[model samples]
Target: MTRRTMVFLAGFVAVAIFILGSIFYTKPAPDFAQGIGPGGDSVLVRPHSPILGPETANVTVTEFFDPMCETCREFFPLVEEIIGDHQGKVRVVLRYATFHPGSEDAVRILEAARRQNKFESVLFVLLEKQSEWAAHGEPNIARAWELAGEAGLDLPKAKTDALSPEVDRVIQQDLADAKSAGVSKTPTFFVNGKPLLSFGKQQLYDMVLAEVGQ
Candidate 1:
C-alpha cells in the first residue's frame, strides 16, 4: 500500500478527529511546468517557508503537512531521500495544514527554530519523539518544548519567537492557502504546482523524476 493510497483509505477516520493540519540547500532556479507551481498569485511558498536544495532545481515538491501527523513523520525520511537522490535537481516547499491537536504550537516551535537556524534540528527531534509529545488524544505540549531543547534549539528564544505576530502570519497564510488550494489532508502534495493526481510512494518518486527529466 502506497502512502498516499493508505492515507486515502484511512483518511476519513483520521479526518473524523477534526484535524488540523524542511530544507536541504539553496535552490538553483529550475524551470517549472506552467500553471501548477506557486507562481503568480499562489501562496504555498511564502517568504517564511523554509526551503531545502537549490531554488534553481528543476523539480519542486510542495507538501502540506501537520507537525503532529504521524503519517507525515513516516513520510519525512522518504521525502528526504527523494530530494537527496535528485541532489540539486529537486527542491521541497513545506507548508502547514495544522489539523492535529497541539499542532499549531508545534508549528510555532518549528518557525521559531527556523529563526534560530535550528529548524532542521528541531523538526527532526519533534518527529523522532512524536509519539511521546504528540500522543494521539493527549498532546504533551511541555514535552515538545523539552524535545526541542534537546534538539539544540535555544528554548527561551524559541518560546518568545514562537509567539510572535510574524510567526502567526506564517501560520495564517498557510491556513488560507490550504483552504484555497482545497487541501483537506496532511502531506498533500504538488509537483511544481501540479496536484498529485494519484498518491503512492513510487508515484511520488516518478513525479519528481519526470520533472527532473524536463
Candidate 2:
C-alpha cells in the first residue's frame, strides 16, 4: 500500500475505534424515573436506615434528609401522610444527608434517639423547633440537645451515644451513599427505587401512587 494511503487508513481505523469504544463504554444516563438507576437499589436502602413502615411493604420511599433543612421539616408530614394513605403497602427509609452546619450534631442526636426507640418523637421535636436551634450562621447545638431531651431521649446517655464511632460511621456512610445515589438536595425522595426528579409534594405523592399501582 502507498505511504499516504496507509497513513489515511490508520487514521480512519483509529477514529472508528474511538467512536465505537465511546458508544460501548460510556455509561448510559441513569433512568431516575425507574428509581433504580446506575446507583442500584443497595444505595437506596441500608439495614441501618430508620424505617417508618412495615418491613415487607411492597413500596419503599427512601428520603435523603438533612435535619436542619427547612424543606425536609416541611415535607416530613407529607411523607407521613403518604404512608398513612397507603396503609401497610408503603414504607419510608430515612437517610441522613446533614448538609447544614449543625446538622451532623442533629443527626447524631437522631441516631441516639433511634437507639432509644424515640427516633420519630425526637425527629418531630427537632423539626418543630428547628428555627430556634438551627439558626442560619450560628446554630445553638445545646438547645437542639435540650429539645431532643424533651422529646424523650435520655440526655446523658444520648450525649454519650452521639459521640460514638458507630454514629459517625453511619453519618459518613449515608453521605457517601447520598452522593452515589445522585442526591444533592435534602428531602430527595425515591419511591420503589424511582427518583422524584421534580421536587414537589404532589410529585412525590404521584410517584408513590404509581409505584403502589393505585
Candidate 3:
C-alpha cells in the first residue's frame, strides 16, 4: 500500500480498538445473587443489619457509601426521599465504605456520632454539607465538629470519640468489608443482595421495586 493509505489504515484500526475497549469497559456485569446470610467476616465492620423498617417490608435496600464522594452526596436526598415514600415498606441499611482518603476522617466523625446515638442525624448533615467541607484544601475536622454539634451531638465528646479505638475499629472494618464485597466505587448498593447496575435514582427505585414485587 502507498504511504498515505498505510497511515489511514493504521489510524482507522486504532480508532476501532479504542471504541471496542470503551464499550467493553462500560458494559454492565451480569447480575449475580449473593445469598443473604449473616454479615459475618465479609464486612469490615458489622453495621446494624436488616436495619428495621416496617417489620413486614419484603425488600431490603443496602447502600455502601463514602462520606466524601460527591456523587453520594448528590444521591443522598433522593435516597432519603425514597425511604420516606416507602416508609414501612422498605428497609434501608447504610454501610460505610471510605473510598477516598478524606473519607477516613468523615467516617470516624460519623462513628463518633453513632457512639452518642446520633449517627443518622449527623450522617445526613454531613452528606448535605459534603461539598463545602471536602472542597476545602485541608480536611476540616472543625467543620465536622460543628456539624456534629448541629446534629445534637456534644462537639467536645464527638471530637474526642473520633480518635478513640472504637471509631478506629469501625473505620478499619468498613474498609475491609468494602474490599470483601469487591466494591471499588462510592455509592455502590445492593437490592436484596444483588448489585445495582446503574447509578441513577430511577434505576435504584426500579430495582428496589422489582425486588419488592411492587
Candidate 4:
C-alpha cells in the first residue's frame, strides 16, 4: 500500500479500537446513588437508633460505625463540623456496625446511657477516650463504663441495663440492618441514604453538601 494509504488505515484501526474499548471496557461500578438509596427511609434508619441534631432537619446522614473504629474516632469531629455548618438543616442517625472485637460492649454502654438521657454525653466522652479503652490487642471495656459515669450516667443502673434483652435486640437488629445496607466496614456513611462516593473527609463533606443543596 502507498504510505498515505497506510497512514489512513492505521488511523482507522485506532479509531475502531477506541470504539471497541468504549463498548467492552469494564470499570469498577460506583455504588453511590445519584440521589439516595432505594427504600432508604426504611433501610437506613431504625426507629431506636441514636440520633444527633434536630429530628426535623431536612437532611439525614446515617453512619454505620463501630465504637472501637479508629477511623470513626477520627472522623467524628468532622461529622460534628458538617452538622454545625448545615445550621439545623441536617441530622445524624447512628447505626452500629460493630465490626471490632469489643465494640459490642461499648455500644451497650452507650445504649444504657441513652436510658439515662446521657447518650450524647457518654458517646462523646467514650469517643474522646476511645484509645484508652479500645486498645488494639487488649480492650478495656470497664474504662468505657467509667467514662459513662462521668458523663452523668447512673453507673450501677447502666451496668445492668447494658445487659438487658432490649439492648441485645437493638445490637442484633443494627447488625442485620448494617448488613442489609451493604456496610462491610466501620464508618460507612450515607447521606440521605446515599453512600459517600468514596471514603475521605472531603468526599463525606461534599456528599453532605450536595444533599443539603438539594
**Count of clashes, each model:** 23, 2, 3, 0
TM-score of 1: 0.80
What is the lDDT ranking, best to worst? 2, 4, 1, 3
Between prediction 3 and prediction 4, the one with superior lDDT is 4
lDDT of 2 by residue, 1-214 (tens): 8999999999999999999998889665454434332223477777688888777788888899998899988998898899899898988889999888888999999999988999999998999889989988788999999999888889999999999999999999999989988988898888876678778999988888888895
Superposed by TM-score, candidate 3 places the C-alpha of residue 51 at a distance from the truth, in angstroms, of 4.3
lDDT of 1 by residue, 45-147 (tens): 6656777667667677889999899889988988989888988888888899999889999999999999989998898899989999998878998999999
RMSD of each: 14.7, 4.7, 6.3, 5.4
My TM-score estimates for the predictions, one after another, are 0.80, 0.82, 0.74, 0.82
lDDT for every model? 0.82, 0.86, 0.72, 0.85
lDDT of 2 at 12: 100
**Looking at model 3, how many pairs of residues clash?**
3
Give the C-alpha miss distance for residue 177 in model 4, angstroms.
1.0
| lDDT per residue (tens digit) for residues 48-167 in model 3 | 432435534556666788788888888877777767877767766677887676778888788787788888888888878776677645667668768878889987877888899877
